[model samples]
Target: GESVGLHLPTLSVQEGDNSIINCAYSNSASDYFIWYKQESGKGPQFIIDIRSNMDKRQGQRVTVLLNKTVKHLSLQIAATQPGDSAVYFCAAEGNGGADGLTFGKGTHLIIQP
Candidate 1:
């Protein structure tokens, strides 16, 4: 099942490692999916995005994979740095318009440097 707004965020990790987070979505009509990273006191920053028409998307050190068949998604961070520590969230564009995004409960990525 996909997540709504009632979820909390938390992350913990070591200084220089890699982390991978997961997300589950339920909307088949969603055409766009995005992954964002939010630090201690900041808003979400776009990490990567994949269109429903595509299966995967990649960014600087981030990768987003979309499995439309099972309605599942995942994000992989390579060579995670201390600064890479943050809460990660997966969002999907609603059926109607691209303006509104449905966010999932984020996973906290903690870095112990």
Candidate 2:
């Protein structure tokens, strides 16, 4: 019934530029939040995560901001580069993993020289 897909299929930027990845979730009752980065054929790597009780979380060279009021989520990347070019996805734990996560379509991030 619910599915997660990418918002922007592709994104391009310079080696020293910044990137912003966006994701939209269907389930509003989710509690846990996680941001993953998939590079090519590799598995998704955990970037950052936050709970419903908190609104923002930060990590090394990454920051995640959650807005439960609108059910919208966004990931901000500082100093984007070729290595940062990958598919970014946001997943939410529906009802504490009861219903699972409904991932977004997905967004392809591309880096330029």
Candidate 3:
């Protein structure tokens, strides 16, 4: 049914390089999107977010892009670092924001030296 998923399960990036994580959602009605980062043994931490009305949003070191027509989303990280190694997930909130979010399988971001 309606679900979110990533194009890749694992992504490797060299230190100091930029990283891009992609996701796809099946729900066309989804209005809000969120990107989260989860470290080992920790819950997912909010990284960035974008609304359907907008196409892009930026945070301190991250940027989130939304493509409503294709139901695709992506997160870009600047200057990959060791501390950035984590599993990143994309979530979608639909049904007027009452039903909460549906998360993707997640992508393991590996920072390589």
Cα-based TM-score, every candidate: 0.84, 0.88, 0.96
Tens digit per residue, CA lDDT, model 3, 7-38:
99999999999999999999898989999999
Any idea what lDDT model 1 has?
0.78
Better of 1 and 2 by TM-score: 2
Of candidates 3 and 2, the better by TM-score: 3
| Candidate 3 TM-score to native | 0.96
| Per-model CA lDDT versus the true structure | 0.78, 0.79, 0.94
Which regions of candidate 2 deviate over 4 angstroms?
1-5
Q: Could you give the C-alpha RMSD of every candidate to the true structure, in order shown?
A: 2.8, 1.6, 0.9
TM-score of 2: 0.88
Q: Which stretches of candidate 1 lie over 4 Å from their true place?
A: 1-11
Best by TM-score: 3
Misplaced by over 4 Å in model 3 are: none
Q: What lDDT tens digits, residue by residue, belong to model 1 across residues 1-113?
A: 33433133655656666677777777777888888888878999988999989888888888888888988888888888877877888898865564589898788888777
